[model samples]
Structure formats: structure tokens, C-alpha cells
Target: MSGLVDKAKNYVAEKVANMEKPEACLSQVDFKGVNRECVTYGAKVSVKNPYNTAIPICEISYVLKSDARVIASGTIPDPGSIRGHETTVLDVPVKVAHSILVSLVKDIARDWDIDYQLDLGLTIDLPVIGNFTIPLSRKGEIKLPTLKDVFHKK
Candidate 1:
């Protein structure tokens, strides 16, 4: 009886391992805008759902790091759902305080850009599988806006 139960557990584990799940990519990061207190940047995540129906997203958690320091970290609860058999683009806004950016002037002074690593977890409620998180990471440089660009009108 114990052996039969173990075999059933193994079967289920194998099935879950072979299941086709959603995939995500941190597509791009760019300068969003600047405010009085902080500068805002936007990260774009592209997610492709494989299921036949829409999957409800539980949360989108993100960590933005620079110079081995966490510049920003937060969770966006219940952003929405991913469409079935289609790709969805989600925008995550990251705000870094002026103080934080001031602390990294050395790196920025080189080329007027900041080097960053963005870590994101895309959590979704999968049928029968419960909640699953898709981990994604991206490393790149964000070019800072020049004084002219900031004051330029659209």
C-alpha cells in the first residue's frame, strides 16, 4: 500500500514537471520621467500564456539593483490576468529617490548612464498546479536624460 502511494506521488510529480507553463521575458527598461522626489523608470515584461484560458496573475514582484545595492523593491498585487494563447505586455514602474541616484554618481559620471540588474517574479494561478512563479532577470544600462531632453516639450 505504501509503495502504491509513493508511485502515485511520483506520477503526479512527473506530470507537473512536464507541464507546459507560461513564459516571461524582461523585454526592455527605459527612462520614464522625473519628479520632484524621485526619477521613474519603466520596465516592460512580456508574458506568453500556454493554457487555453486566461490565468489570473497573483502578483508581480520586482527588485532593481545598482552597484550591488537595492535601489528599489516592491510588489504589485493582482495586476491582472494573462490572455490565453497570447502574449501580454505589462509595465512595471520603478522609482528611485534622488538621494539614491546621488549616491551612484561615480558610475553615472562615466557615460551619463546607470548600470542595473532587474529581478522580477511573475506569479500566476495555474489550474490544479496552484500558484507558480516565473523568474526573470535582466542586466543593462539606462541612459540618463540630458538637461535639454528633460526641458524639451513634446
Candidate 2:
């Protein structure tokens, strides 16, 4: 009887391992806007659902790092749901304080941009599969707006 139970567990594990899972990627990160206190950047994430039913997103957590230092981190709860058989795009806003940018002047002066790594966790609830997290990471450089660009009239 114990052997039979062990075999059943192994079968279930194998099935789960072979199941179709959702996939996601960080598409782009760009400067969004600037406010009095901080500059905001938007990170775009594309998620593809493989199941036939819509999956509810549990949470989206993100960390923005530069020079191996965390510059922004936050969690977005219950952002929405991923459509079945289609791709959904989500936007995550990251705010970095003006003071923080000032501290990195040396790096900015060299290339007029900031190099960054964005780490994201996309959690979704799959039927009969519980909650699963799709981890994504992207590295790139974002060009900073020059004084003329900021003050230029549209």
C-alpha cells in the first residue's frame, strides 16, 4: 500500500512538471515623467497565458537596481487578470527621487544615461495548480533628459 501511494505521488509530480505554464517578459523601460520630488519611469511587461481560462493575477513585485544598489522597490497587488490565449501588457511605474539621481551624477556624466537592472515577479493563480510566479529580469540603459529637453516647448 505504501508503494502504491508513492507511485501516485510521483505520477502527479510528473504531470505537474509537464504542464503548460504562463510566460512573461520585460519588454521595455522608459522615462515616464518628472514631478517635483521624483522622476518616474514606466516598465512594460508582457504576459502570455496558455490555459483556456483567464488567470487572476495575485501580485506584481518589482525592484530597480543600479550599480548593484536598489533604487526603487514596490509591490502592486491584484493588478488584474491575464486573458486566456492572448498576451496582456502591464505597466509598472518606478519613481526615483531627484536626490537619488544627484548622488549618481558621476555615472550620468559619463554617458548621459543610467544603467539599470529590473527584476519582476508576476504571480498568477492557475486552476488546480495554485499560485505560480513567473520571474523576469531585464538590463538596459535609459537616457536622461537634458535641461533643454526638459524645458523645451512642445
Candidate 3:
């Protein structure tokens, strides 16, 4: 009896492991806008849904780090649902406090850019599998807007 139960468990585990799952990737990151309080950046995420029906997005959480310090982190709930058998692009906005900019003087002095690592989790509710989270990460330098770019008169 125990041997039969073990075989059944193994079969279920193998089936779960071989199931086709959704895939996600960080497509791009760019500056969205700057306000008096903080700088806003947008991360474009692309998700490929393999199911035959739409899946509800539970949440999208993100972390932005620079100079080994966390610049911003937050959770965006219920961004939307992903279309069936198609790719969806979602924009995640991150706000960095104005006070934190002062702490990054070292990187600013080296270059007019910030070396950053963005970590994002795309969570979706899937049938049978329940909830699944796809973790995505991106590392690159984001150039700060120069005085000309910021103060340019239209």
C-alpha cells in the first residue's frame, strides 16, 4: 500500500514539473518624470501567457537598488489580466525620494548616471497551479537628465 502511494506521489510530481508555465522578462527601464518630491522611473515588463484563458494578475512587486542600497520598493496590486495565448506588457512605476539622491553623490561624481538593479515579481493566478510568481531582474546604468535636458524650454 505504501509503495502504491509513493508511485502516485511521484507521478503527480512529475506531471507538475513538466507543466508549461508562464514566462516573464524585464523589457526596459526608463525615466518617466521628475517631480519636486522624487524621481519616477518606469519598468516595462513582458509576460507570455501559455494558457487558453485569461489569468488574473494578483500583484506586481518591485525593488530598485543602487549603490547596494534600496532606492524604492513597493507592491502594485491587480494591475490587470493577461490575455490568453498572448503577451502582455505592464509598466511599473517606481518613485525614489529626493533625499536619497543626495546619498548617491559618489556615483554621480563618477558619471552622470546611476548603476541600478531592478528586481520584479510578476504574480498571477493560474488554473490548477494556483498562484505563480515569475521573478525578473535587470541591471544597468540609467543616465540622469542633464541641466539642458531638464531645463530646456519648449
RMSD (Cα, Å) for all candidates, in order, is 1.4, 1.8, 2.0
Model 3 lowest lDDT segment of ten: 145-154
lDDT of each: 0.93, 0.90, 0.90
List, residue by residue over 23-138, the lDDT tens digit for candidate 3.
99898889777778988889999889888999999999999999889989999999999999999988999888879887998998898889999999998998877899999999
Residue lDDT tens for model 2, 1-154: 9999999999998999899999998999998778798888999999999988889999999998888888889999999999989999999888889888888888899998889999999999987689999999999998887787667767
Candidate order by lDDT, decreasing, is 1, 2, 3
TM per prediction: 0.93, 0.91, 0.89
**CA shift of 130, model 1, Å:** 1.2
**Candidate 1 deviant stretches above 4 angstroms:** none
- Evaluate model 2: give its TM-score: 0.91
Q: Best TM-score goes to which candidate? A: 1
Give residue 82's lDDT in candidate 2 (0 to 100). 92
The TM-score between candidate 1 and the true structure equals 0.93
lDDT for position 113 in model 1? 94
Model 3 segments more than 4 A misplaced: 1-6, 147-154
Weakest ten-residue segment in model 2 by summed lDDT: 145-154
